[model samples]
Target: MKTINTNIAYKEEGTGEVLLLIHGFCGSSGYWGKVIPMLSEKYRVIAIDLPGHGESKALDSVKDIEQYALVLKDFLEELGIEKVTMFGHSLGGYITLGFAEKYNQYLRGFSLIHSTGFPDSEEAKKGRIASADKIEKAGIDIFIDGLVPKLFAPENVESHKQSMEEVKKIGYEVQPQGAKNALLAMKNRKDRTEILEKTELPVLLIAGESDQLIPADKTFTASGENIKQVVIEGAGHMSMYEAPEELGNAILTYLNHG
Candidate 1:
């Protein structure tokens, strides 16, 4: 069901150890729809719409992913949830890292799906600035149409056309200001690779075998024994849509054994 806590909107289902799902840029709790039912069969799944996206209100003065992490702490406290195995996709992963850095007590473990803990390379920062400008000049729809298709592996683009559209539909709902703000937050995010590599807490790193946006090399940076990396075949950055079952199973295996 949909609920609001501390102004954050979320979808909660099933019951057991909480498994929190956080979606990427231009996404909401809806991005987890395909995998939630499958994973929720064995665990309580809570998917949140980050501020400024989905149904959540935007933080007008939001400066970085760290602020979003603070919002999440308040959100979880409001719900009386003390711990969760957080799984973050794309931009969501950055916020997760911030949480891990500042609030380890709140996480049992965490996963970064199709995301990296490294700071934005100069090239990426430039791209982010350009994207923000595009959102301001042309609005969300135009930018989303051009961006979503590139998230999929080239081979899956034609085959998963419907799923692509669904993603776009979700992207279209992102408030323009929210999208632009998210870009700025991401561009300013710091490198959290140390948290991923050195944390004693169990960590799961999932990479889409053919993700054009973030390759496996970037996602599998942690060499510590505490980290587990899985690459979903026939998938890209949008594995939640391209390979939900595989993605869900990877998470289950990690949770079961970690």
Candidate 2:
């Protein structure tokens, strides 16, 4: 797919209802490599590299989640995608919440994959600043080495060596500026719990059984008639790699019946 000069880079496939896949921090559209083909079988799939990740260029400064959401809106408009279902992983989920808050008109439904609606704790905020500073002082490679391994459930790390390596590869490819910006954006994001209670659209919250970053308790915090939650067994923060089949089924079910 072509890159929009002022926005994100993306890859599109299939042809039916639109399903937008937004990658998490440190990931590009390539993060969805495994599930995109499966989802595209029944619906059009557009996976985008959020600014600063993948092949997408970095923004000049750290922008808030709202700004990231607007970037998504602009992307959809540029593609003439009037309505869509969104699946966001990690940081992608935060941007999705921002989209749900500001551009609900263009949404059919949305899912949070191993993600949360809560804003960062004060400690987490300080951690983000430190992470950014570390990247600036050192380099992205060392930072990625430390971060990528933590993303997997410890149990799965040994068994899923190839998968873990892929995650690390993507992490290593991340533009330092882009990763830093995402960290700042996530740090500043507001608690979007109200969007969960307010939007009439279907909401799917998928948590990994072993996600250390955002545990199931944090991911499963919201509840409503429109909300559905699924916990993928034996998975971690990177469910798309650890358990793509389960992730795909949850997404397909939401699209078909949500």
Candidate 3:
């Protein structure tokens, strides 16, 4: 397929096979701060701050998950990169699924960290809308304040205070319209379980044992000889921040042996 038009912003480091990182909602490339240094030591790492969420300009014309996947395809082609092992976190996972289904030509493999292949349930859709409304009425900061803490294991919040604050700082920078658009996209995302069920390529699923957003069981929708799943102890949704060392090791293991 020909490259679609896009102007995505990204951070690249080290040198080896490409490992693309797609951050979750309200996050930027900075989300992989600790993990990048660890993984980049052995392999090339490229972390992108998706449009409207990082330095990239918002795409007002594109409001669906399919468009987000196209944007990523163009991002890779623009850099002259041919293929990559993509790892998507939370909201990023939804986009990764879209990419895997439509743009698997560029994927060597892919992983979903603390994410699921299931679609948002009816109740979950309402919650997504509620969050968008909250951002519109109360403001982004209020929504971020309440959202960030819930992303961590409640018992470990005090210990991971610094990382929690860093996440909040990043969340605050998200463009309001961009954030709303993402919520709408997520609320309407399709079920992608079948995509994983049939893939023969290496597939890795990493879930936080204590993930407050997506349970470990939920992330394991598909299983096969080619699928590898790991559950990190004590981590919540943001494993990149809560347990970077363990998260990095899990990713390294999948890349090296899977």
Could you say which candidate leads in lDDT?
Answer: 1
Model 3 stretches astray by more than 4 angstroms: 1-5
- Show the lowest summed lDDT stretch of 10 residues, model 3: 1-10
Candidate 1, 48-138: lDDT as tens digits: 9988788987778666898888988888888899999999999999999999999999999999999999999999999999999999899
Query: Candidate 1, clashing residue pairs?
Result: none
Question: Model 2, which residues run further than 4 Å from truth?
Answer: none
Superposed on all Cα atoms, the candidates' RMSDs to the truth, in angstroms, are 1.0, 1.1, 2.7
Please report the candidate that would top TM-score against the real structure. 1
Model 1: lDDT of residue 218: 92
The TM-score that candidate 3 achieves is 0.97
Off by over 4 Å in 1: none
Per-residue accuracy of model 2 over 79-188 as CA lDDT, tens digit each: 88899999999999999999999999999999999899899999999999999999999899889888888899999888999987888888888888888889989998
The per-residue C-alpha lDDT of model 3 at residue 204 equals 93
